[model samples]
Target: MLIGKIENWTKERNYAHPVIRRAIDFLDETDFSLLEDGKYPIWGDDMYARIMTIDAKPRAEQSAEKHERFLDIHYLLNGEETIGWQSLACGAEPVRPYEEEQDYALYGALSEESLQAMKPGMYMVLLPDDIHRPGLSETGASVIRKVVVKVDKELL
Candidate 1:
């Protein structure tokens, strides 16, 4: 997992993958206010962005999830949020089965969960091995706007 502020991407480190760079660039260049909640292609089916405005629930009310085929890039646009992450090796049981069409699967609490409070310009790059519980609030349910960019592993 890679976490950093969107504005710091150009200086913190050099990114080599074009797909990864494009995903970051998309976040930097796009005016999210002009977009509605939906998926938009960044590089055809190989990469896409999902935009949403959600009223986040507490961590207890949510389940962590992982993707099999794509790595996720999440950018927090507004509001405060706490995201939980843990190692896939932690042996947590899945609360729900994997759905191939959606490339999604849900898991219950892990052996060691780490919490991250996202700032407005913060972004996270979660890989297939990353088990993350998003859309959760620090204290209680709250509204937040974010964009998640999904990039196929083939492009990595």
Candidate 2:
């Protein structure tokens, strides 16, 4: 998870995957001036999770990916979004990989077990082991800022 101050982000990445570590560095150094106006999608990969900006809104139903690992770098620049996540240990099993998206795996069923409320300047990191259901509302839509950086598992 990307908690604490920005200065420590680099140090924290030393232990994270190499791809993720480099992605984090890239995100940290980039200027978020464009976000001041509204939410924007920075980068995304169809193979993995769909990386994009989710304006303040209620959490939506998501088919959590399984097997393959994931790297979710959620950066909140404006409002807040309550991100839901569950573990395979407590959630449902994963389905076989589909050719449509090899980076993602289908899940059986799931229940909410963990929640992370993120706001401006706040961010979180989710690994493939983490089944996150993002874009939930806590107090309704409120101008939210965000950025998603997609990373490949091979690099991690």
Candidate 3:
């Protein structure tokens, strides 16, 4: 998993995939405040983004999910949240098997997990091997407006 401020995207773009760079460029140019909550297609099914405003929950109420077919680029537009992450190689038992239609599998808690607080202008990139539990709050439930860009693995 990778985490950074969106303001540094210009320099970070050099190390990112071309498609991811395009996604970052699109994000930099768009006004998320004007976008309604919904899925917006960028490059057909290969890449797309979802704008959502939801309430944060406790970590215990969230599940660790990993995707095999796409990388998740989570960018916060408003509010804040604490995301939990653990490496897939840690051998955490899967509570739910992978659902191809959804492209994710839910895993039980890992012995070691890290948490990061994300606020507006911040982003987190979760690869297929990054088991992540998002939407958690450090304090309590709060509303968060964010965009999640789904980049197909083929683009990597």
Candidate 4:
């Protein structure tokens, strides 16, 4: 997992991962206000960005999830969000089986879980091995708008 500010990424464009660098470029170049809430293709099926608004809830109300085929860049647009994350290596039982079509799996409580406070200027990169629960409320904020860019693991 990686956490970074949009400004920092702009200043330091030489990210080690080419795909992640392209994802950051997508965020940096687009005018998000012009687009509606939906999926937008970047590099066809291998990469796309989903823009949506979610009602932030408490962390306990959410389930930790990890992806198999795709990695995610959770780029915040507006409002505050708190995300709980832990390594899948920490060991947790899956509450639901993995759905290959969706590339997601839900897990119960995770060990060594920690929270990350997210704001509009920041983005988090979540890998296949990262168990994450996003959009948890921060300071009682209700709504959060974010662009989740999904990149196929094959691109790594």
Candidate 5:
């Protein structure tokens, strides 16, 4: 698992080492007590920067469509979460929106070779082209702390 501050991630590229190191540092310095609420804190113009409190209960399985314009820098604040990831290389079919409230739509089923497990303090940065399924269960339910920082495709 990785933990760190967002400001220290300034020099990050595609590799995970430096970014992961910075995340660890960030977690050590910040007071995450304000994250008890399920609401996300507002940050940036297009970036989704908020502390996510995932409950220790099973969550609805869902995959986010491959985004054309952002990178997802998800940092787990607490507990553990196993996120499912799929590759766009296999080709994806579009689907209807699952929850209009969240503006997230489900993508087509993926080949089994693409899933990944993410635990507490560990983070994953989903590139603009990566298809991801976040918030799943392992041991019943677990609360996960996360922050999603979106990077514009133009910068990548």
Candidate 6:
């Protein structure tokens, strides 16, 4: 997992894959305000971005999920949210088996977890091995607008 301000992308570019760098560049140059909520293709199915407007939920109501086929770049566009993350190697039991069609598996409560407070312009990169629970609030539920860029694992 990686978290940083999009504005400082240049410094981090060296550490990212070329495809990921391209996605970051596209996000850096695009005007998200002009884009509506939905999936937008960038490089066919290999890469895409989805604009989402979601309501924050409590920790108990949210579930930790991990994707096997893609890495998620969670970018905050408006409002704030708290996302919990735990390493898949930490021994958290899966609540359900992975759904190949959806590329995700839900996990039960994590015995070890870390939280990240994300505000507008900040982004978090979640790899396939990272179990993340997004759209949570530190105080209480609130609405937030964000974009998720999905890059195929093969691209990395």
Kindly report the root-mean-square deviation of model 4 from the true structure over all alpha carbons.
1.0
lDDT of 6 at 143: 94
TM-score of each: 0.94, 0.68, 0.96, 0.96, 0.65, 0.96
RMSD of each: 1.2, 4.7, 0.9, 1.0, 5.4, 1.0
Candidate 4 lDDT, 14-38, residue by residue in tens = 8548888998899988999999999
Q: Report the lDDT tens digits of candidate 6 across residue range 31-115.
A: 9999899999999999999999999888999999999999999999999999999999998878988999999999868999899
Q: lDDT for each of the candidates? A: 0.89, 0.59, 0.89, 0.90, 0.56, 0.91
For model 3, residues 1-156, the per-residue Cα lDDT tens digits are 889888998878899878878887778888987889999999999999999999999988888899999999999999988899999898887899999999999986778889999989998989999999989898988999999999998987
By TM-score, how accurate is candidate 3?
Answer: 0.96
Candidate 1 lDDT? 0.89
Ranking by lDDT: 6, 4, 3, 1, 2, 5
In model 2, the Cα lDDT at residue 16 comes to 66
Judging by lDDT against the true structure, name the best candidate.
Answer: 6
Q: lDDT by residue for model 5 over 1-156, one digit each (tens)?
A: 133334455444335554333433454455677555443323344433556665643434554465665566676666677676766676766575445454344685666435456655556777655777777666786666676555454543
Backbone clash count for every predicted candidate, in the order shown = 0, 8, 0, 0, 15, 0
In terms of TM-score, which candidate is stronger, 3 or 5?
Answer: 3
In terms of lDDT, model 3 sits at 0.89
Model 1 clash pairs are none
